[model samples]
Target: MKIGELVKQYGVSVDTIRFYEKQQLLSPSARSDAGYRLYSNADSQRLGFILRAKSVGFSLQQIRELLLIEDNKAAWQCADVKDKVQLKMQDIRQQIAELEQFYQALAKLDQACCGGALSATECSILTALEQGKPAQPETHQEDASC
Candidate 1:
């Protein structure tokens, strides 16, 4: 298929497909007489996998490792894949904890604000920011929804 067909089929921009080619993630299987790139069904499948991996926050390097494993499955172990997923999960959990801390701090600062007819210099949130106040500790009483 032509590059235009691929872009329309995948709902991605031409530049995105070109970038994948430049990154060595995807390659044209052949070129037409007019010098247009030609792709195969297998290439389309690989592009789909690349898009899915990116959607889940996989870096291009990580996606490359996955593609390598896909190309040579007999030489790779499932344990290696599991290890990478574990590391990603750990990073996500740490990020969530940090975000929760930030949320608490922002909430405290917002509550402290009087919202009166005061200038920015007199704002409590601004004063707290100027003083470099630390984030508040999380209260860990479990909620049913959580």
Candidate 2:
């Protein structure tokens, strides 16, 4: 089989397959005399693993470590993999917390800007953003409520 055929079967583009090979997420197949890659059933199966892992939001570096861990599965058990997963979950949780903080800050700014047709120079949202948000903002909820 060829790379193109395997990619089509997995609903991925040919460039994506090549990129994965370059990224070390997929290994290159043996080449013929003319230097064309000769993909085998094993390559297809490996590609399937790469695609599924990517779908789960694993980073390329994480995927590389996972592939290394998987290839040495004879020496490593499920507990080893679980430990790695737990660490990645910790990193993801931190990111979610930071994003939520950002969202809440923006929501507060939106609340302050609900004031309709205020003087542009005195606009609370613009002023807070330009000067960096203060501990308190001008109250606009008194004027606009929905």
Candidate 3:
């Protein structure tokens, strides 16, 4: 099939497929007499894999590494693939933890303010920010009203 066919079938832009080709993530199986790129079923499957990996947050580099392992599956152990997934999971967990901390800090700052129609100069939230007061949850009192 031609590149246009892939675009229609995959619901991705032509540029996206071209970029993947440029990145060595996807390639045409052959070129037509008129110089159009021709892809095989295997190429379509590879594109599907690339899209699925991206949907799950895999970087292009990570997808490339995964494709390398997949291409040489006989030479690799299942543990190798599992290890990569585990590392990604750990990274996501760390990001979640950091986000949770930020949420707690913001919640503290939010609770410190009454969300009233007070002037900006009298706003507790703005005051905390201007004073460089840290929004550490432990240091903030939930009962404190603006």
Candidate 4:
């Protein structure tokens, strides 16, 4: 298939496909006499893999390594794949924890503000930000809450 056909079929932008080509993630099987890039079913499958890996937060380098393993599946070990997955899971967990902390801090600030014609100087969120501290909850319950 042609590059244009690949773009339409995958619902991905032409530039993104081009970028993947430049990154050495996807390569055309052949070029037509008219200079158009030509792809095979194998190339299409590789493109799908690249898109799916990226959607799940794999870096381009990681995707490239995965492609290498996929291309040489005869010598590939499942343990290597498991290691990569574990690292990704750890990073995701860390991100979630940080986001939860930010959410808690924001909630505390929101709860502190009454929002009745308060000036910027009196805004709890603004004051907390200027003080470089998260606003404390007005009432601390005995049980842990976020």
Candidate that would win on TM-score: 4
Residues forming the 10-long window of minimal summed lDDT in candidate 3: 135-144
lDDT of 2 by residue, 1-146 (tens): 87778877999998898899899778667987878777888888888887887787778888888888877889888998898788888988999999999998988887666566545676777778888965245554545421
TM-scores, all models, native as reference: 0.84, 0.81, 0.81, 0.85
Ranking by lDDT: 3, 4, 1, 2
Decoy 2 TM-score against native: 0.81
Single out the weakest 10-residue window by summed lDDT for candidate 2.
137-146
- Give the alpha carbon lDDT tens digit for every residue of 1-146 in model 1: 99999999989999999999999999999999999999999999999999998898889999998999988989989998888888888988999999999898888877666555546565657767878874233233322110
On the 0 to 100 scale, the lDDT of residue 127 in model 2 is 77
Best by lDDT: 3
After superposing candidate 2 on the true structure, give the runs of residues whose Cα lies further than 4 Å from its correct spot: 115-123, 135-146
Candidate 4 accuracy as lDDT: 0.85
- What's the TM for model 4? 0.85
Q: Candidate 4: where is the Cα deviation over 4 Å? A: 137-146
Instruction: Assess each prediction's global lDDT (C-alpha) against the native.
Output: 0.84, 0.79, 0.87, 0.85
Give lDDT tens digits, candidate 4, residues 41-96.
99999999999999999999999999999999889799998898899889899999
